[model samples]
Target: MTKPDQIKNRYNRVARCYDWMESPMETAKFSKWRRELTRQVTGNTLEVGIGTGKNIPYYPEEVKLTAIDFSKNMLKRAKLKYQDDPRKISFIEMDAQDMIFEDNTFDTVVTSCVFCSVPDPVKGLQEIRRVLKPGGQLLMLEHVRSKQKFLGRLMDWFNFVPLNIWGANINRQTIDNLKKAGFTKMEVNNLWRDIVKLIKVRNIK
Candidate 1:
């Protein structure tokens, strides 16, 4: 299988248990960050890697939303969870690196804890930039390689195990990758010790 396919399969295999594994973190910390990041979203929105629909409940009711995930199993679970919500959300199974969307299509793009697993992070971000209208905002809640030397090295050492077991890398330089993807006006708020960041950027195309 290709690398992306491998990653997709990994997520599919874990879809049923994904939320359980994340329960502790989500309850204590991630849920707050997800809420804070999603509440800022407005206009027609696209959420990439909308895993398990964790951010769905937090989005404002007025915003029109479309969400996608690479794993069909994951999207299936997400759809079930949000099936009865009042606000409409379209969920699709799609690869982040090659989204089937027109250029300059969305007014806002958002993601939560996603980029770490994308096989080609820059390529995925480039696709996000492509579908985003000029002046559209990209909001992200992501964990990256730590800035502190010892902790960063520790995360680097631990990353390989998760990459093999769950298809997630704990040592990605996501902020740098976003810049490389061509987003110029950006603001980053360190949510937790410089590892988890709330990043907002604009597509200036």
Candidate 2:
């Protein structure tokens, strides 16, 4: 199977247990981070990798929300999770590296724990930049490789496990990939000892 197919299959298999695996820790550790990052989302907002629609409840009601996931099974579960919500969130199956939207289509793009799983992080970020309007903002909540030598080495060692099981990497340099994708101005806050971060980048065209 191709790389994308492998990713999709792995996520499909894990779709049912995805939220369960993270809920205990995420509820305690990431609730504040999710609220802080998502509160700034406004206007035409696109959330890439809207796994199980966990971010849906946090987003403000006024924003026009469009969410996409590469895994069809993931999108299916997200739709079920948000079906009763009054906010009309459009969910689509889309590859972040090659989105179908026209250029300058979104005013803001948000991602949470997404870049680590993208097969080509820079290419996916470039697509994000392409779809976002000039001066638009990119908000992200991600866990990346630790900067500390010993901890970073530990993450590198364990990275292969997640990659093999879920096609997710634990040691991606997502902030650097953002720079490589042409996001010049960024405000980064270390959320948890530099392993998890809240990053805000603006598209200055």
Candidate 3:
């Protein structure tokens, strides 16, 4: 199977229990991060990985929203959870590396804990850049490789465990990847000891 297919299968297997598995972290940190990230979205918005609809309750009601995930099962759960949300949301199954939207389509793009699992993170981000209008914003809440030499090396050494078991990498240098994907201006807020970051990017082109 292709890498995206592998990721899809892995997520599908865990979809039914995924929300429950993440509840602990969600309650402690992710919930607050989601609210902080979602509330800043404006105009036509695209959420790249709307897993289990966790951000559904936090989004502003006036913005037009479209949410996508490659795993059908995960999207199904998300749709069920927030079907009654006041804002009308379009839910679609799409691969981040190859979105179907036209160029410069979205006013803002958002992600949460997503790029760690993308088979080619730069390619996925390039696609995001392509779909965003010039000067559009990209908001992300992600856990990335530590900058501390010791912890960074430690994460690299054990990165294979999460890659093999969960199809996610724990050692991605995501800020660098964003630069590689053509995002220029950015504000990065360290949320948890340099491990988790809330990144706001201004798409230059």
lDDT tens readout by residue for model 2, 85-175: 8888899999999999999999999999999899889999999999999999999999999989999999999988998788889999998
lDDT of 1 by residue, 55-87 (tens): 998999999999999999999999999988888
Candidate 3 lDDT score at position 156: 94
RMSD, every candidate, angstroms: 1.3, 1.4, 1.4
Clashing pairs in 2: none
Task: Give Cα-based local distance difference scores for all models.
Answer: 0.92, 0.92, 0.92
The positional error of residue 110 in candidate 3, measured at the CA in angstroms, is 0.4
Spell out the clash pairs found in candidate 1.
none
Q: Which stretches of candidate 2 lie over 4 Å from their true place?
A: none
Model 2, residue 185: displacement in angstroms? 0.2
lDDT tens readout by residue for model 3, 1-205: 1378887898898899998889999999999999999979999999998888898888898989999999999999999987777787999999999999999999999999999999999999999999999999999999999999999999999998877765788999899999999888999999999999999999996
lDDT of 3 at 161: 83
